[model samples]
Target: MSADRSSGGGVSRRQLFGVLGAGAAGAVVGAAGGAGVALAATGGGTTDASGAAASVYPYFGAHQAGIVTPAQDRLHFAAFDVADALDREGLIGLLTEWTDAAARLSQGLEVAEGGAVGGSDYSPPTDTGEALGLPASGLTITFGFGPGLFTDESGADRFGLSARRPAMLEPLPRFQGDALVPEMSGGDLCIQACADDPQVAVHAIRNLSRIAFGRASLRWSQLGFGRTSSTSTTQATPRNLFGFKDGTANVKAEETAIVDDHVWVHASDEPAWLAGGSYLVARRIRMIIENWDRVQLGEQEMLVGRSKGEGAPLSGGTEFTEPDFDKTGATDAPLIDADAHVRLAHPTSNGGARMLRRGYNFVDGNDSLGRLDAGLFFLSFQRSPQQFIDVQTSLARDGLNEYLKHVGSAIFAVPGGVAEGEFVGQALFA
Candidate 1:
């Protein structure tokens, strides 16, 4: 009950970085401290791994609105650079490992008395996410593997699981060489596990990373979304990031009929495995909580579709509760701010299409530069990026854009899952 940031047998706050666990914002901690340390652990010398770092990422989710939110906040993300030699054989081995790891997480693991596994080895975070207002997240774990993960044919190894294709997002202003976000940028990690108990999340990720990458290295981290529940929520959730319940505006798979009519495109060109999969990951987010908290309790209620304490739509009820869009002038009354993020991403407005969002907040180190780092990794899964594209294009011009910034971005074309010994995109490339 003590902050829950620490579990019962949790490692002393001392070990929160390595052996303990970092949060979504700061997980990028090195297995030791900086990327140099991480590189050293995996064979320090650089091997002429260079390329024209693309100035613009294709189909990035930067400007895309987020559907998942703080209530859905318990999450972690890790991005890794895969060792080369990833071919049909490597993919086979990789997927097999995924199936195995998924099995263990689904069943649960031996949680340390502190709720995390004990005796694990990792350096301590030089700093907890003080600027971010959240204690380091406990259990959440996320995964990312670089492009080489799938494309590299050499013996280079991967750090974790990856989306395998480029993603698209609208670009934002660039950072000077000293920015912290460049450090928090994307790649791949093995898994993302969030939970009520930080210890449970740590325990889950530690084992999950061990199994997926042989050794899980810390990378990028942060804490967000405060929830009343044990889930240790963060602003990463869909609703509150923009100061309102965000994802309620999204569409679900079961509601595919409606989605097909609006959001999705089942073209004859696409193959079968992608049939059920939808494209377009909308990631509209903001940090109005600070502002919301400032408003009179009653005023906050009228501004959002839900209540502050309950998180339910203003029409009535508790969190995870339904929103009453039908409250007549409630809609026209602009009870919800006109420029509010929720107002932009709603189904009645721009959310006619939906993307499966899977991302976490990130908080990296502060250097001689003026401050620390903060923002969301904001990821989405869709059959095509188009669905997400339309929604984001709408938000890019909305009111919520003031607080949030579209920083790092990239677009990856995820290929189909492989069959026996085939690399993921063997059908297209081979």
Candidate 2:
């Protein structure tokens, strides 16, 4: 809750360069065996081997900060539609501005040179003051481009760069249990800001939205709490609203080979600009709480193909045990039902396709009937969009489908990270 001004307070644009220069010097010295080198000379807090209090992911790197980064506890996901008035040049300018702001914010610094109160009293504050005195809290901001950004509804090349659109960056197909609401479905651009503290995440999005005023308008936004998946082996698996362990088979960050093969796109993957990027698929899956809570314990176990308590496969084993799909019960039937969620969604059954999931549980008050309007804001990243499509298509027969409805969905082509002097998606614009 306290502001960290360890490096120095009230930094200007000019001061940032000096700070970065020092950081580079520190990196060089660290490579030459300095005593305990920091990740960046900004002097962000360092944690012990346990990674307990201080964990910071650098903003500028080969890949964006949030994708493979460990999941944060809170989320602020906002989607925007580019303004028709913004031509190519204007759009690029906005992106450049956003990149600078994101970099500063992610490093636990103010969005602008003067920050919130340092600006003129007569003008609106450049930086929102909500997270004024907060640490980075492991904040990470990720950007993506939706299909509509390339072409309009009528299929006109609005941006004059439609030919550059990645082949995998298209609208998601309707699934069997989809009850999609148009307002929450598609967007021209998206930004996902996550952090351990809710205020930090919200503040990041608020400042970005302010910076994007003339170029993009918010389509819809969702605030999520209680992450439901673990992205790294260092973290423990978290449960979803249904009370069953989720993302048990998720692609972990430690699995470098699998991450490279299934998550990051290659140079030969059609759109050259998106070579190191990845595809993101988001689904707002609403669980029918009243109905699901009424189901019998045994029935719920059957639906998920795992134990409700330990989250172990019904065939028997620990939580991380590979599910034995061939095991038969006393009645001579397959132990894990063919329509069970785990069975249908497993990689072994889906051509070895996998996605790095970073989902969070959401609750939005209540519905008209007084039932809680809540669900999982399911988010996943993969090398190819088809990998997600194939898996979702196979889940059409999942028994869990009866108690769930896909209310909102979107897909975005997230380009690779920005280099020190470059803006996000700069390669595509070039």
Which one is best on lDDT? 2
- Model 2: weakest 10-residue lDDT segment is 24-33
Superposed Cα deviation of residue 136, candidate 2 (Å):
0.4
- Taken over the whole model, the C-alpha lDDT of each candidate is 0.37, 0.80
Per-residue lDDT of candidate 1, residues 317-361 (tens digit)? 566555555554533664455544445556456545555554444
lDDT per residue for candidate 2 within 11-61, as digits (tens), equals 355544533332210000000001122233212334446342144667888
lDDT of 2 at 280: 89
Task: Tell me the spans in candidate 1 whose CA falls farther than 4 Å from its real position.
Answer: 1-25, 28-73, 85-88, 109-180, 188-190, 212-243, 252-338, 356-379, 407-430
* The best candidate in terms of TM-score: 2
How many steric clashes does model 1 contain?
A: 94
